[model samples]
Target: MSAENGTPETPAGSTPPTGPRPEPIRFFGTSWVGHDHGYTARRIALAAGSLAAAAVACLVLCLAYQGLQIADIGSFVTLLVVVMFAVCSALAFRHTWAGFSSRPDPDRQASLRGLLTIGFIGSLLAYAFRCLIEAPGEKLHRTEYEAARARHEKRTTRRSGNPKKRRRP
Candidate 1:
């Protein structure tokens, strides 16, 4: 039987469809519900800025709590934690943009990874903390972005360098 829209309708007696629900698309913990590169970039950059701000705020709070005194044991410990998270977050942010690019930036990635390694060595605790949130997502996005980019490059190069165009007069 056909419905008012001229499309066939499933019989009422038939079993309903069953499958897993689609996962919601999210950017930086915020659901986009739609894809737009500009919006995505803005959200990603904002997250980076927020992390940097958190690092500065931590330093300020630590100082205030100590009545603006010199570095002590507690302050030193706080510095390590704050620096670790801040540095990692900054690297993650830079890598996020690199991940989004059509071409991968190996040098940038290497440098950032180096910084992350240093931070990890300095404070394993904070590095672990930031990695818990950033690493998996970054890796997944980077892979997906690179694969799509490679495909695009392959298609364009084949199209732009046609055999007909290479014929000499």
Candidate 2:
């Protein structure tokens, strides 16, 4: 009476078992939706849209960086901007993911609105902080240049076009 064969098995014969779950799938508020093959298409489209948005943002940032290179403090500013951008974006993504995981059916539009709102606020705050932090450097430079120009002007006198001295030598 082997356990595999139920030779107890033949006392009462049986066979080995193998099969998937008997339970039905529930997708998008409807059962049996997972059985259909069309969901993959929807998933692909979603992925493509996300990739396109990311590509556009990256391209814009790279091109715009070249124009900003004239600033002496551009490297520090650029580093701050990039770090802030990444952090804010990560936070927005986290908020949306949490919202989605908690809800039976999340309000996607609300998530989008929230994401945009949060991003704009973060950008504004970062810009304000950067400006405030950089003010001292700008102020010092402006005053230094002004003072140097004033000193130079006072120390040296400009020559008149006409010479008044007699030419006898």
Candidate 3:
């Protein structure tokens, strides 16, 4: 431990430990750490932009559904299509939201690719939702960065001993 600050000291002859650098979140960069460089403004813009895009997509989907209705497609078929899209969207939203908090399984993500593609609107909505609160994936990146800093501190800490004064073992 260091006498000056009660923190561990780096070993002599070794470079001093610099704190771990934070990994950048999408669209936020390192600004999330200090909320500098217009982070708040960027968040607001992204949230609004994504929400507007989702609204436009919903309108397009509504038009397509109306087209199907005009074609006299069987009621059962139209209902099934609607249900499928709804289920896919809900699943995509949940998956995307969970991914922001932790590393997702690659195989699972791969399997969900089709569903996610079909329900891209849900992903956009999730992004907007997260931006309103915090940068997406910010928490997970912070956790990993903290763990790395701890590891660096542990590795660089000097052991308390004088080799010349110790008895040979």
Highest lDDT among the candidates is held by which one?
Answer: 3
| lDDT tens per residue, model 2, 18-120 | 2221222122111112323333443344345455555666667667666567555668898886776667666655543343223323466565665545354
lDDT (Cα, tens digit) per residue for candidate 3, span 121-150? 899899999999888888898889889989
Model 1 lDDT per residue over 30-73, tens place = 12223333445544555565556556655665675575244455
Task: Compute the lDDT of residue 27 as modeled in candidate 2.
Answer: 23
Q: Give the number of colliding residue pairs in candidate 1.
A: 0
Clashing pairs in 3: none
lDDT value for candidate 3? Answer: 0.86
- Measured with C-alpha atoms, the lDDT of residue 50 in candidate 3 is 90
Local lDDT at 33 for model 3: 70
Error of 2 at 112 (Å): 11
**Each model's C-alpha lDDT?**
0.48, 0.45, 0.86
State, as a TM-score between 0 and 1, how close model 1 is to the true structure. Answer: 0.27
Error of 3 at 102 (Å): 0.6
At residue 88, candidate 1 shows an lDDT of 71
Model 2 spans with C-alpha error above 4 angstroms: 1-32, 35-37, 71-73, 103-169
